[model samples]
Target chain A: MAGEASSGTFLQGLERGLAVIRAFSAQAPSLTLSEVARDVGLTPATARRILLTLEQLGYVRTDGRQFSLTPRVLALGWAYLSSLDLGELAGPYMEELSAATRESCSIATLDLPDIVYVARVPTSRIMTVALGVGARLPAYPTSMGRVLLAGLSSSELDVYLANMQTEQLTPRTVTSASLLRAAVDQARADGYALVDQELELGLRSLAAPIYNSRGRVVAALNVSAHASRSTPESLCEEVLPHVLCAADHITTALKHRGHL
Target chain B: MAGEASSGTFLQGLERGLAVIRAFSAQAPSLTLSEVARDVGLTPATARRILLTLEQLGYVRTDGRQFSLTPRVLALGWAYLSSLDLGELAGPYMEELSAATRESCSIATLDLPDIVYVARVPTSRIMTVALGVGARLPAYPTSMGRVLLAGLSSSELDVYLANMQTEQLTPRTVTSASLLRAAVDQARADGYALVDQELELGLRSLAAPIYNSRGRVVAALNVSAHASRSTPESLCEEVLPHVLCAADHITTALKHRGHL
Candidate 1:
């Protein structure tokens, strides 16, 4: 409905078009006209018009009946990624963290109520999900999520808590807003966050916030280790140092370059 | 101009908004409203409204004058990548190819006249550019580009050759359309493409095309190596076999799963 809102300054057609794109996910990659309209809360006629525009723009393709996106849509994301020097700066640090911990390392930033991965250095892991850049996870169950949540201002945190829904992904996952707030506060105090089997049953991760030159947390860095190989305490003791060291170095480099 | 065209079915606002997004590239990532209007050929007032809409949608952020994109825009690309089973199917094969060749392996698809990287398996190298998924390179000077170009139908190839400009990145680069067509034809006949120091000074690459269940070429796979480490002949002899095997295996897998 937010996208459907039209004002003098807000382009409803553009918003609805983007909504239609977002309506397609991994589970529902292709959709018929009515399906797209229903998913994005647009009329079939409007959806058809937007789809036609997208197809003309080379961002989408339709096989007569079902409409889907094309790889050219990636240029949109690249515009954002290439604009920032964060990913380029963080790539080496992420690689070093992955090397030191012998595990996967990733950097993510907060967006709305979820944290979106901006950069990653992956290891061949058995239990980890195959994820790449632009992958999203909820903000209350993961270590980076907590660090990012702690970075938010009180008003922003209030909006997030008001809008987000919490589910128990694992038994260790915190579901209540108060508990989530407490965890965020703890992360803020410690300058790091650790989650043990909160996202997955056998996964433990430790994360530290990466501050920009302005002392704002622009992103969070995390080392994800399998529980069979390391516990939260061990992760804190062994991997946290590397994570913090990388965080500090990244911050110093960003400050020197004024990258953020 | 194409986006600004409005028909009964084509939504002008939608195309214009997407054009605004595409106007920002790696070189001019952050642009002023006037610059964006000039780049996309829109009025200043129209660009402002579209930028306002994008900013409201959390895709673009403006620091008073210069407007830049946000990571939330990745969902547009994610919609396309998630819709395709290509990445998940090709990830392991790419990893194997990278491991076997001790070089970088990547899978890319033809989008318009460019090759957009969909998935990549990287090796830590000294001279290679730090590229990730969603990176684009012109489809006239590289191995994957030649393979993808070869995959296009005759009429499709005609449109591409007519529209795309060839640039001489290096002295070895073929700038003539006839030469490019010859290379593409050679790639098609050989079932692979190899380019030696055409795109870069000391880089060599070998590529193979992957087809779908219906025998349509969908993506191209390639192995990138350094000239100091491997020659074009060596790339063909040592790395090309692995690339073809992986390409064949990926095609078979996609066929079995009807994944394309």
Candidate 2:
């Protein structure tokens, strides 16, 4: 897109190559040359060349006709994780909390209308959709998302709400902008958030803000469980204290390490 | 490097762009334009364009002059992790083993002479260097590395041995090729590998091979602890059984999913 605006400086080939890599997702883990070309808007011959180059670099592998990303591609994401040091700083606390709660604990940072999980420690499989590090969830329906959304400035939150596609992911999902805004305001006042069966049936999560050394809310930490396992009142009474404490511990650790 | 040989088919700009991203590391998390250009072996003008493109794509962030990757880059690795499904399949078992043994547990796959961690559940920080998913360690001195290396065919092992740079990471590290070969042979015969203070002075680890449905060794799972906390006999008697059991559970799960 930048290439269209400034063709002289931008490297469109680089953009196209990354798009090719991204075209392979959970829905389509592997694809043929033509599929890749069509998915990324490249010619078949160009896609073949890029695939060949990626294969040569060990980022991709080919089973003659189909191409898929290799484990080596994980290094691309590793570069960012290692630099962020989020896992290293927050992992032990999340692990302890998950162990204590017998549920999934995760850390996520705001990425506009979506919150992307950066680190997760799972105790059991609770949701139909498998959630892991880097999974994105809408800010309006999830506890972590709401806490992160609550951290944003009013104007930033307004802009996010203006462009947000408020779909009803589940019957409990808040589709009204005003209701969502009130939820976010409540999260800010409470210093934590609780979402019960909003993202999916039988799922509930509680989240608390994680602050950096500068006292800025940089991420949100959550504990998630099945609604059958945890009622909203129980989540607040049992899980909220642990989640808040773990979030505070991580914040303190980050501050001690001068990561803020 | 492949671009140098096959310039016609390779998108050198893509290669350069990735190199630029990889230029940021734990030691240098943030870089100026000139620093990035110098590290990636590109001109300032070219590096600026790539950085601008990445920034626009939300993969990189800039603070006036300095640039660093954003958490969105984790999605690139998530694509591979979610597709591989290794973490999802292996995580709960790793957590159980870690909890039972009170030691760190990890799963790693061989990548030439290095072993890349695919999944990890750590109980406590024992090593000087942080080891997480996607962290790479030389195969010669680590227990997981040895287990993975032992899984290779004789010819493949020979090729790896020939290319390996056998550095003396610690006083306990085996530097002789024949000695390392004997260690690999022992691992093959024992069905597990144990290394004490080899990779790091205070670290002890034991690893077992995890096989796919086809009975091919696909990965190695290990339990690690401080040498002060675990002796060789303790590792053999206490840690080995849990590590082997966890690996078997993961292998069986993989088989059930028909992933092998």
The candidate that achieves the highest DockQ relative to the unseen native structure: 1
Which tens-of-lDDT digit does each residue in B109-152 have in candidate 2?
87776788877765753221266677888889999889888888
lDDT of 1 at B94: 78
* CAPRI grade, predicted model 2: acceptable
- Provide the global lDDT of candidate 2 against the true structure: 0.82
Q: Go through the candidates in order and give the C-alpha RMSD of each one to the true structure.
A: 3.4, 4.4
Write candidate 1's Cα lDDT for A52-83 as tens digits.
88888888788889888888888887777776
Off-target runs (Cα >4 Å) in candidate 2 are: A1-6, A92-104, A123-129, A213-215, A225-249, B1-6, B91-104, B123-129, B153-159, B185-191, B211-216, B225-260
**Candidate number achieving the greatest TM-score relative to the actual structure:** 1
lDDT (C-alpha, whole model) for all candidates: 0.83, 0.82
Interface root-mean-square deviation, each candidate: 6.0, 6.3
Q: How close is candidate 1 to the true structure, as a TM-score?
A: 0.94
Model 2: per-residue Cα lDDT at residue B125: 33
Going through the candidates in order, their DockQ values are 0.49, 0.35
